[model samples]
Target: MALVIEGEERISAPVDKVWAALNDPAVLKEAIPGCQKLEMKSPTEMAATVVLKIGPIKATFQGEVTLKNLNPPNGYTIEGEGKGGIAGFAKGGADVTLAADGDNATILKYAAKADVGGKIAQLGSRLIESTSKKLAGQFFSTFGEKVGG
Candidate 1:
């Protein structure tokens, strides 16, 4: 299965602050709804564990996430690959852009693409797309609250 998601969010914080929040493992761990762990191995590399449930199917995925194409207070791209044992695997990336809105505000936009294989692909595209959107919505809602607070 292949899926793409694109959206924008307005944050009540500066671009630099938003960028910092994005890079902080603690913030990520808190913001990702099903994330179990996020360990930063270096400035641009990290390992993560996420548990996802789609209807009757549940899977735990372990992955390495990388941040690249970074431009401070502007934008960056993140890519990751997750293996879900027999359930199969997923690989994806997102391009995130941040624009200053005011002294303490920023607008963020993201374009994401993902590919899934194995048992997951059997779930059908509509199901996968809906689930992905739900997860993305949850992630951003949590992130916005955290960053704005």
Candidate 2:
């Protein structure tokens, strides 16, 4: 199934700082919910391992993330795909944009689309969507704190 999600966050940090944080693996690893490992393979690519629980299922996913459309301190598109052995596979992409709220703050907006296949897909869209939404929220909340601090 396919899912789409969108939201905006007001971050208490400069747009440039927020953009730097977004590209930092150390910062991303802390912000990402259930992220066990996140390593940059190149300037635009990263490898990751994440553990997640969805309803009655739990799985560890190995994934790769790519950043596209360079627009320093402004925005870009992030795409990723993950495999979870027998549990399934997931793939998604999000377009993220950042605007300055002030010299010391920024507004971040994102629109995401995702898909799942295999056992996880059988669980239904509601569950998957909710879980994805929750994870995304957690990431931004933590990210805001980390960068804003």
Using lDDT as the measure, which candidate wins?
A: 2
| RMSD of each candidate relative to the true structure | 0.8, 0.7
Indicate which candidate wins on TM-score.
Answer: 2
Off by over 4 Å in 2: none
**lDDT per residue as tens, model 1, 49-114:** 999986567999999999999998698999999999988898999999999887998888989999
Model 1 CA deviation exceeding 4 Å by range? none
| Residue range 67-136, candidate 2, lDDT tens digits | 9997998999999999999999999999999999968999999999999998999999899999999988
Q: Give lDDT per model, in order.
A: 0.90, 0.93
What shift in Å separates residue 24 of candidate 2 from its native position after superposition? 0.2
Clashes of each: 0, 0
Q: What TM-score fits each model?
A: 0.97, 0.98
Candidate 2 Cα lDDT to native:
0.93
